[model samples]
Target: MRIYTRKGDDGTTGLYFGGRVAKDSALPTAYGTVDEAQAFIGLARAEAEPGSELDQLLVAIERDLWVLMADLATDETNRAKLVAGETLVTDAMVASLERRIDDLSARFTMPSEFVVPGGNRVAAALDVARTVVRRAERDSLAAAAPGSRVVAYLNRLSDLLWTMARWQEGDSLTARAVAPLAGEAEKGA
Candidate 1:
């Protein structure tokens, strides 16, 4: 009933099914980063209109992160216990993200160059989430099993986050849009 178990005080944390590992171990690090990304996604969701498509989509993604964290938290010994689309990352999940990315990308004029993040509050939050998702993706690589789809899911999730941020921004400002530095202009002259 109480939240604090005082179990992790020893610097090790419990996995989903069973077993423990250091708090800084690869699986914990990966899932912890996924938790962070989910929080930022919540911030973006809060900024969206209630009942809006963006809000709904963010809610779904947030729920998916729970499944992802569960997948990452389970050790290889208990890997067989994971349920696809529930406790484990599934191909359907990755494909769903890809489909959303394509749909959202179709709604906007894709920027030809790198984008500056702060276009608006929701978009900015989405951008921050996207970056965290990227970090999660990298971390998952070290934690994932050889045939695990966790890494693939994180990879596609990051891409979907990028596309969502762009969709929320309406018009993304590309890196090329920045004015030349005064000294650079003088040097060119």
Candidate 2:
């Protein structure tokens, strides 16, 4: 059980199965981004109002992110066979996030402007989590197999992060500017 197997000294790492891959492989990138999101989620939880709903929800998010990281750690074939029944991220997970997002977004004014990702410590960390979640979404999409749920979870998780930040911090905390995204309005339309 030595921590140093010395196997990855040359930029290669072992996966859950017997397979190995380069350190910079796509699966790792997805997991790394998810890990970054989870760390930022932890930061938000620590800074949020103690025992509040937001803090409780973030703790749940961190647990789900760990599950996502585990899925991404394995190769596609082994990932398909993983038997962690309740731990798997699912469409119902996406629905739960939607409920949370809608609950928070109701307090905010929808905008076509770009807002800075800082205000309160919790909010800022949540914003960081949002961007990392976005990266995780893209990377997971790239890593996704035909029936994978990882990418979808990341997509919804990022949206949840945005609304959670606005909830924990006031909407006015987000700065005003032009929209960074084009055709964003049309998508909502």
Off by over 4 Å in 1: 171-177, 185-189
Q: Give the number of the best model, judged by lDDT.
A: 1
Count of clashes, each model: 0, 0
For model 2, what is the C-alpha lDDT against the true structure?
Answer: 0.77
In model 1, the Cα lDDT at residue 171 comes to 53
Q: Candidate 2 versus the native: TM-score?
A: 0.81
Question: Mind giving the per-residue lDDT tens digits that candidate 1 earns over 57-135?
Answer: 9999999999999999999999999999999999999999999999988887888766767778998898899899999
Predicted structure 1: clash tally: 0
Question: Which lDDT value does model 2 have at 171?
Answer: 48
Candidate 2 on 29-148: residue-level lDDT in tens?
778788888988898888888889888999988887877777777786676566452435677777777888888788876545455667578889888889988988988877665676
Pairs with backbone N, CA or C atoms under 3 Å apart (clashes), candidate 1:
none
List per-prediction Cα lDDT, in the order shown: 0.90, 0.77
lDDT of 1 at 33: 98
RMSD each, Å: 2.0, 6.1
